[model samples]
Target: MLRIAVPNKGSLSEPAVQLLKEAGYSQRRDGRALVHVDERNDVEFFYLRPRDVAVYVGQGIVDVGITGRDLLIDSGAPAIEHLELGFGGSTFRYAAPAGVAASVQDIHGKRVATSYPRLVTEHLAQFGVEADVVRLDGAVESSVRLGVADVVADVVSTGTTLRAAGLDIFGDPILKSEAVLIRDERSDAEKIAVLTGRLRGVLTARRFVLVDYDVPGDRLEEAIAVSPGFEAPTVTPLHGSDWQAVRVMVPRADINDIMDRLYAVGARAILATELLAVRV
Candidate 1:
């Protein structure tokens, strides 16, 4: 059985659970459930705080974990990213009360507040600049106003929170982050690959859709040119003659344009379906 650690709360939890459910694994219906056993799949899931996920996986307490990339870096855990989950997205950046520092260099020897102290310290080290890093539990953006620190390093999603607090972002982003699957540097490779393959199927399903359409047999080649799939398009003959049906998978972002082109090229009955799951 594969052992998995999932986020207990915050932005990453729900989507992580949904991904597992989509991969044909059983997940606990209630958030308070500490552990769940998917007997059919021979997997066990443990719910833990997002920040602690990397530690557990790194310590070999769990075979794999899902956590924010930022948290993993801050924890300094010995875990390798098994896959990028593409959710719980955010940016880690340095901000200050509007115009305090023009760049990261200007903030040298000043106070910087952050929930992610380790990441902030490590980032500044790369620039050969060190400062007083004030660690706060939450509401890091307010630390500057409250006089705990002159500048702040924290997660910026829309920049609204920073602006509301009269802060402005400065410097290049410290780190771009999103939720990711992680495993200890040393682990059971074959078992991890099985779980990784299942999740990859879910990720692929979310990214693409199934498209079906009909066209005159002669125009089939033309229609296919509009939406050729990753593999060869599935072409089939129609019931009464002179026509054929075509089916292919296309990226969700290009579906509307593909539909338009297929129709213009003499295709009919075009349809696209949301894929629940895919293997490849």
Candidate 2:
């Protein structure tokens, strides 16, 4: 069976399990269960903390795993990103009490507290800013006020947490991170490929919707231009009329605007339908 690692808890957990379920895998109903086997898929899921996902993959204990990109980088693991899961997006940034620090340059010789010590250390090295790194498991924003560190490097989502701690973000984001599927070079190649394909299909299905419309034969080309799909729009001649029926898959985000454009070009009866699954 192919072995896989998944985040056991935190923000990445629910989404990871949900995506797996969507991709036709069986997940454990009990959150406390550490391991779940999907006999039909011939896959085993090992739930671990998000930070440890890369470690297990790199150590060849699991074939592949889902984890945050920042945690992967911080682990300095041999695993490489197999696929981007496209959720759990956040930025790693440096923060300090307002007016105390304003840029990356200010990090020099300062005590930097962070959960991801390796990531912060390497980032500081890029700027030749040598600082004492204080590694904390959580509540990094409070480090400055508690006098544990002069600056803190941690994941920032809405900046609400930092504001509550009397800290403000300084400089550009050090790193942009999102949940990704990571794989080990030593893992089973065939099984990993199969999983990758299923995930790609699910993500594509979520991103796009099917659109159908009718347009006069003369305006078919214009309608096609407005809603060209992954390859080409499907066109079928209408019965007993100078009209054609068009069908295409368009991005869900742009479906509304695309429909209006199609309508302006003489398209009628425009319809958008949800796609449950798609290979491409």
Candidate 3:
């Protein structure tokens, strides 16, 4: 059976679990359960801390795992990213009290506090600057105010928290992070491929919607140009009439605009439906 590691809690946890469930994997119903077995799928899930997910996969304790890109890099684990999960998006950056620091160079020889000490250290080294990296577990934004550090490097989802703490982000983002599927080099290739395929299906389903419409035969080319789908739109003749039925998958983000364009091209009976699952 393939063994998978899941984030037990934090921003990456719920979304990761939901994605697995959508991909037809068994997940723990209660938060207290550490291990979940899916006999039907021949797989087992081990719930661990988000940061530890990479460690387990890198050690070959789990065949694969899901975690954030920032956490994976901070851990310096041997595990490699198999797929980007497309959620839990955030940026890692250097922040200080207003104008206290303006650029990466200003951080040189200053005390830098962060939950991700390894990531902070490496980023500073790339700029040829050195600093005392003060590692803290949480509340990194408050570190400078509390007099523990001069600068803080942490995840920035919005500038709200930094503003509330009298801190402002400085320098370019150290890393753009999101939930990702990670795997060890020793994992079984066949099992990993199957799991990756299922998750890819779920991602595609979430991003697109199925559209159906009827268009006058003479205007078929115009309608197809408005919503040409993956590969091409499916066109079928409407029995005994000078009309055609068209089926296509369009990006969910542009559904409204596509519908308006189709209407302009003389297409009627246009309908858009959510996709529950897709393979391509």
Alpha-carbon lDDT of model 3 = 0.93
What are the clashing pairs of model 1? Answer: none
- Assess the local accuracy of residue 276 in candidate 3 as a C-alpha lDDT between 0 and 100: 78
Query: lDDT by residue for model 2 over 60-113, one digit each (tens)?
Result: 999999999999999999999989999999999999998888989888888999
All candidates: CA RMSD (Å) = 1.3, 1.1, 0.8
Q: Which stretches of candidate 1 lie over 4 Å from their true place?
A: none
Q: State in Å the error of residue 197, model 1.
A: 1.0
lDDT for position 162 in model 2: 92
Cα-based lDDT for every prediction: 0.91, 0.94, 0.93
TM-scores, in order shown?
0.96, 0.97, 0.98
* lDDT, candidate 3, 1-280, per-residue tens: 9999999999889999999999998888889999999999999999999989999999999999999999999999999998998999999988998777999999989999999999999999999999999999999888989999999998888888987999888899999999999999999999999999999999999999999999999999999888989779999999999999999999999999999999999999999999878897
RMSD of 3: 0.8
Off by over 4 Å in 2: none
lDDT of 1 by residue, 54-103 (tens): 99999998999999999999999898887998788899888887668979
RMSD versus native structure for model 1: 1.3
Question: Which candidate, 1 or 2, would have the higher TM-score against the true structure?
Answer: 2
lDDT of model number 1: 0.91
